[model samples]
Target chain A: MGKRVGLEVTVAVAEAVALCRIDMAGVYPITPQSHIAEHLSNLVADGKLDAEFVTVESEHSAMSAVIGAAAAGARVYTATSSQGLMLMHELLPIASAMRLPITMAIANRAVSGPLNILNDHSDIMPQRDAGWIAVFAENGQEAVDLSIAAFKIAEHKDVMLPVSVNIDGFQLTHMVEPVIMPSQEEVDAFLPPFVPHATLHPSRPVTMGAFSMSDYFTEIMKAKDEAIKNSKKVILEVWDDWGRQFGRNYKPVETYLAEDADILMLTMGSMGETAKIAIDELRGKGVKAGLIKLRLWRPFPFAELAAVLKNAAQLIVTDRAVSFGGPGGPVFSEIKSALFAQANRPAIYNYIIGLGGRDVAVSDFVGMFETVRADKAKAKADTYEFWGVRE
Target chain B: MNIVENFDLFAPRLINKKELFSCGHRACSGCAEVLSVRLMCKALGDNTVVASATGCMEIVSSMFPTTAWRIPWIHVAFENAAAVASGVEAGLKALRKKGKIDDRYIKVVGMAGDGGTMDIGIQALSGAMERGHDMIYVCFDNEAYMNTGIQRSSGTPMGASTTTAPAGKASSGQKTWKKNMPEIMVAHEIPYVATVCPSYPLDFIRKFEKARSIEGPSYIHCFSVCPTGWRSPSETAVSMGRLAVETGVFPLFEVENGHYRMSADMPKKLKPLRSYFKPQGRFRHLTDAEIDAIQERVTAEFNKLTQKAKFL
Candidate 1:
């Protein structure tokens, strides 16, 4: 650790990327994610980070450029959010299909119909199948740590897939928090120079993104699926190494006072801290309420999540994005699907909460817990309710 | 003997250099696009990487487990070839500066069809050029979306029959004239921009060679004849490309730092537009009035180019 300084989460993200010594960055400006681009350009301009900063006209080009840079054996970084991520949707699978380890930071925001540029997971939920290793950050420190760790995990020899760190828009990205930024020397030691598995070079020629017909398309997709599934092992090891080096431990499923709790609340992103506070208040009232936050979104962490929630009697899963006409929120649906066949599983209730930056206070969490505890029959397994929605 | 010797003087040199692009790929029998690509690759030599767009060239050249390309090549998507090439150049630059790779100059080239370059891909191409990336962008102008069965594209010339813009009693085939992509590249104020036709193989090679030496963005718009899309005989593909330039339909020129110069000498007596359009089945429906209209437009465009070249 170098020093604990108050820094905006986006700046910390840029600093983390700078420490990693990226060779190229192609970024487009989008709301709630512009600071990352701005700070990165500044870094490149100031001669602090020796990287080519290409101001791409749009998110599509940004992703395309990053993919190109990665294919050329460059350590590349980019950042975007919400509509920007949606704009990059077409190239997302291509990046993974080509197996370019290009890391991107997504300041997660609500997708627009009414155009809400605020915190939500709606943006990344659609990209869950885009073949990228998606991770979530709870706050500024995790944003910094994961921003750095994403490069390591993505460039790992076993993995070589794109990694996206989702920092919740506005709530986390705009907020200033004390973060222990690792030194450049420490980062250099942690992240070895990126050795590309295969690169575009005249000396050693290779064809990437080749067309696949029906005869071999299924096999190619199956191979990609296996690659992502197997990436979990590398993610875990990288997180473990980070914990040992930095003294701040991280896990796929993090529990807060859930040792013997009868009721458990599940959350993702910055809402976890708020849920923890609610858990503390419920504990003061002699209620056995605990919190569980999912750090790894993609490759779902099924076994670890199942082990953690096995003992709970009830689990309140909060989602910031709606599935709209589906049974519940995206995360809720995944959790239900994961626990569907289990012999002894908790009664899981999903509350779509804090959507589009609606303030989710401690009182809202308490009310949600009270409602879940009061309802004995547990409603239905696949049903969800909108918490704190007016009328 | 004198006529044979003169013809031999203009023939493309069969150098001992290996073909970076090889046979056994799946292009159409008389594809001028592939011919142009083959010649372009030959000019670029071994020290080059290609970022190709999704089109006929990409689909035909890079089937999984087989590739026509002997050099490093990638097909990212339809509209991002220029953007991708920008990334490749930047990545190579970083590697070379860091002493991670030998400091030999390697060329980055972006290849896309007319639809990819003029339609959905315009933004990426413009951005890459504006950023002054050390790369070459080659747009094979077949003038329609031939990969998707000849849909009308912005590059489609006026009065041309296509699936999307077919000729009828009430309407001419394509309402708009072919978009001038070389002028658009020149507007970007890049270091070099040129127009070439595969029929002139030596001229094509020379333009690409000059483009490769340029330090900044260079654009090459090649007027490729799509015999299948244009409903012409397969054997007429090369003749069609030659007819396009000789009839003043598509001028072969280069713009170096905004200085426009014609690559080939202008025809002393321009061929009539009818001779160029008569053989193409897509233009068979054209009436004499329509032919006259096309002739007027071609002559006017050619004159405008001649004036620009003279001023430069």
Candidate 2:
């Protein structure tokens, strides 16, 4: 066990990467994610972390450099938010396709059009199909824990794919929170030295990221799909191992009093903590409201989510970003699709809330439950409704 | 023995062995770009890893289930070869420091086309060079985007006809001059920077060897003639490259430690620019006035380079 210290979440993440003893970091600056890059650069410059900090020009190059480093068998990391993540969009799939096992921290923020820089899932939503093992952290503690675990999961022999830890912008990244900083020995014991499956070596040379034709492109994509899907097994095992070692058990879909509740509210990222308070309030007033927080967004906990939502008669899903004209929100569409085939599924009602960093109060959650319970059929099962839209 | 005698005895023996970039690849007949890569790869030898950008060289050398590269190679994306090579160099440094691998140094090379290096990839290239990574960056200049059906590129010289900058009633093909890449790299103040062509294989090999021997970043701009993109007869690729140097359209030179020197002998009487431009169909649309303008610019650029090379 290491000492608990009050550290900003971004700094906490940088310290966590330092604990892992990464060989190099390729970083470019973006708002809300700049502190992580700044701290990591300081760590390398101050000789705290013996790593090569390549201050790359853009997010595209940052990803490219890390892919090169990871291909050369170095444990590497980088972080970005919003537009930076979008800029790295082209190389994200390439990183996973090459099986580089690079761990990226996405300070989740809304994508630009109005150019708003606030907490939302819009950044990571478009990258869902980029073939990375995506995980969400509800708070600073989870951010630290999952940031460390991301390397373990990504570098695992069975799950040799890039992993992204999505932490909410400003809400979680800027907050100062007390976190248990794992010691060097603890982290070393947990994460073994990264042994690359296939590295670029002159002695025993290999070809990586070969250009594929139509004949083999489908099979190659199928293999990547299977690799990410099969990673769920290792994810669960690692979570269990982490729980046993650190005494903080994590799950794919975590529940707060949802075992017997008739109504459930689903949330992801930092908003889950706020929804937990709403659930408590609803429970106190005999409304039987509960909360289900999704921790793993990719290789999504489909079975766990179905099992949890099976008992509830109605479920209110809180989405931080809107899908705009397609469905309602990205998470709501995913949940609807996940429960569409089930025979005994909950009537899921999605409320697109907290977009562009819009504040959602505890009373809003109670109101959402009241509205859903009173007129479940009026909102319709196919589409979603906005919670606090100005009329 | 004199240098010419040593080269005569050794250069062919060095390049004629089993090729690092093997023969069965799908490069077009008389493709000078692939020839440049083949010569570069042969010079780099076995202790090298290549990070290639998305271009004709990458696509032709590596089409899945088959690879022409016998040594380690990677293609990350179009505009990131230099950045990726920087990572590879750094990664090898870390791994070697940890004693996880053997002590011998491995060379990392970045290969990109003019489009990948000059236009979309310029930022990454500049960043990598400024950082001074121990890597070699080779910008195989074919003047236009040949891999994407001959689009105009920044490397495209003025008055050259490309698909994107076609010679029409109102336009005289590409409007701008070629972006000076070697000077750009020289401005980064790295240890080694050179311009070579596949027409002179001995010079290309020697430059690559010198580049790999250097301690910091080295940039090599190889003038690779694209027979298809240039709309020239396939057989004239090597001849066109030779004419380019003799005509002062492309100069063979090297800059080491801020000192510049011409690698190839200056033509006794500089060949008319028409001797170089007339052979290629790309410049066929140029009128006498445009040709005079091009000749004036080429001679002026050559004189400026000669003045700088006097430092040698």
Q: Judging by TM-score against the true structure, name the best candidate.
A: 1
B-chain TM-score for every candidate: 0.96, 0.96
* Best-fitting candidate, scored by DockQ: 1
TM-score of chain A of each: 0.99, 0.98
User: Measured by C-alpha RMSD in angstroms, how accurate is candidate 2?
Assistant: 1.8
Cα shift from native, residue A296, model 2 (Å) = 0.7
Docking class of predicted structure 2: high
lDDT of 2 by residue, A255-362 (tens): 999999988899999988888888888788888888999999999889999989888888888888877787778898899999999997888788988887888887
Q: Is the docking of candidate 1 incorrect, acceptable, medium or high quality?
A: high
What are the models' TM-scores?
0.98, 0.97
Native-to-model Cα distance after best TM-score fit, residue B76 in candidate 2, in Å: 0.9
**Regions more than 4 Å wrong, model 1:** A380-382, B1-16
Tens-place lDDT per residue, model 2, B1-312, is: 224336567776667475899899999998988888888888888999999999898888889888998899999999999999999999889889878778988999998999999999999999999998999999999999999999999999999999999999999999999999899999999999999898888888889999999998999999999899999999988889989998999899999999999885456557999989887899998999999999999999999999999867
> Model 1: what is its DockQ?
0.88
Cα lDDT computed for each candidate against the true fold: 0.91, 0.91
**Shift in Å, residue B142, candidate 1:** 0.4
